[model samples]
Target: MSSSDIFLGETIGTAILILLGGGVCAAVTLKASKARNAGWLAITFGWGFAVLTAVYTSAPLSGAHLNPAVTLALAIKDNGIEWSDVPTYFGGQLLGAMIGAALVWIAYYGQFHAHLTDKEIVGGPGAQATKVKAVEAQEKGAGPVLGIFSTGPEIRVAWQNVATEVIGTIVLVLAVLTQGLNAAGDGLGILGGLVTALVVVGIGLSLGGPTGYAINPARDLGPRIVHALLPLPNKGGSDWGYAWVPVIGPLLGAAIAAGIYNVAFV
Candidate 1:
C-alpha cells in the first residue's frame, strides 16, 4: 500500500472503531433515558463487532491495526515493517480515534442534554412537584415528571481505569494474534470470527469489571480526547496521568505473547 493509502486507512479505521465501540458506550451510559445502563455485555459485543467490521473494511488496505499497541506488536514481530512507518501508523490511529469519537459525540448530543436535565429533575422532585402544582392551580398545565438514567460506580480513578484498560487490551491482542496464527493455515475460515468474539467475551466476563476493559489504547485515548474536546455537558476528567498504562500494558502484553508464542511453538 502507498503511504497515502496506509495513512488514510489508519485514520478511517480508527474512526470507525471508536464510532462503533465508543458510540455503544455512550448509547448505553450517556443516553440513559433511551439506552439506560446497557451494561458490559453490550460493550463487549459492541467492541467485538466494531473490530470485526473495521478489520474487514480496512485489512485489505492497511492491515487495520487501529490500536497503537497492535501496530507496535506487529512491527516488533515482523521485521518487514519499516521504522518510519511507526510514526505514521501511530499518528493515523490517534487521529482516526479522535475523529470517530467526535462523530459519536455528535450522534449523542441530544441524549447527553436529556440525561443531565433528568438528573436535575430527579434531584428536587418535591420542589418540581410544587411548581407543577402551582402551574396546575393556575390552570396553565400539569408538568411532566422526567426520569433520568443512572449508573453505579460513578467515580473512576485514572490509575485504576488505565490498569483495567491495559490488562484488557493485552489479553485482547494476545488472543487475536495467537488464534489468528492458529487459524491461518488450518483453513479456519469464518471460525476466526468466533475465536475473536470468544476472546472479547472472556475478557469482558473476567476482566471488564474495572476500567471498562478498554484493552485498546486507540479505543480509550481517542474517545477520551474527544471527551476532553467536545462540548458535551458534564464531561468527566481526562485521567491523563494513567494514560500510559493502556499504552504500556498492551505493548508489554504483546511482547510477552510474542515471546511465549516464539518459545512455545517454535
Candidate 2:
C-alpha cells in the first residue's frame, strides 16, 4: 500500500479500535452508565467486536495492523510490509489511539466524574480496613480512573506482569501470523477478521486478570497519555512507574513470535 494509505488506514482503524474498546471500559466501570458493573465478559466481547469492526474496515487499505507491536512483528517476517513503513504505522496508531481515547472521555464525561468522586465512608463502621487501604493507595498516588484508560497489575510483581503480557501477546501475534492461510493470508479476509476478533476475546477472558491483556502498545500508551492530559475532575495519577511493562512486554512477545514463525512456519 502507498504511504498515505497506510497512514490513513492505520490511523482511522486504530482510532475505531480504541473508541469501541475503551468505550466498553467506560460503559462497565464508570458510575451511572447503563452498562455499569457489567463485568469482564462484556468487556471481552466488546473488544472482540471492536477488533472485528476495525480490521474489516481498514484491511483493504493497510492490512489493519492497528497495533505497533503487530506492525513490528509483520515487518520482521518476510511479509511485503516494508521496514520503511514502520514509522507511518506507528504514527497512525498512536495518533488514532489518542483521538479514540479523547472521544471516550467526551462520550462519558459525566460517568468519569461520578466514578472519581465515589468514595466509601472513610471513618465509618468499616473504617479500620478501608482507611488503611485508602491511606496505602494514597501513598502510591495511583487513582481508580487509570484502569479505564490503561492496564495495571492485580499483583505488583514485575516479572509476573511482564510474563502475563508476553504470553498473551504471543497468542495474539501468532494468531495474526497464521490465521486464514489461504489465498487471502496477505491480509485479513472476512473470515480472518472474525476469527482474529474471537482470538482477542479469548485472550481477554483467559489472560486479562493480571494486567488486562494490553497486547497492543499503542492501545495502552496512547490512552494512558490522554488519561494524564485530560481535564477530568479528580482523575488520579497515571502510574508512570508501571507503564514500561506493557510496552516492552508486548514488543518482546511480538519479536519472539516472529522469530518462531520464521524458523518453524516459514
The whole-model lDDT of each prediction reads: 0.61, 0.85
TM-score of 2: 0.92
- List candidate 1 stretches off by more than 4 Å: 31-33, 78-80, 120-166, 181-194
lDDT of 2 at 84: 92
Clashes of 2: 0
Candidate 2 local lDDT, 21-101, one digit each (tens): 999999998777999899999999999999999998888888888998888888898764678989999999999999999
Candidate 1, overall lDDT? Answer: 0.61
Q: Give the per-residue lDDT digits (tens) of candidate 1, residues 1-266.
A: 66777778889877887788777777766544366578778777887787777766665557666777766665665433565787888888888888887787678777776754664422356467745543442342111211011011123465565556656666766665666532222111244445765776788778866545556667666666666566645434454555565566666666665555456654
TM-score for each of the candidates: 0.76, 0.92
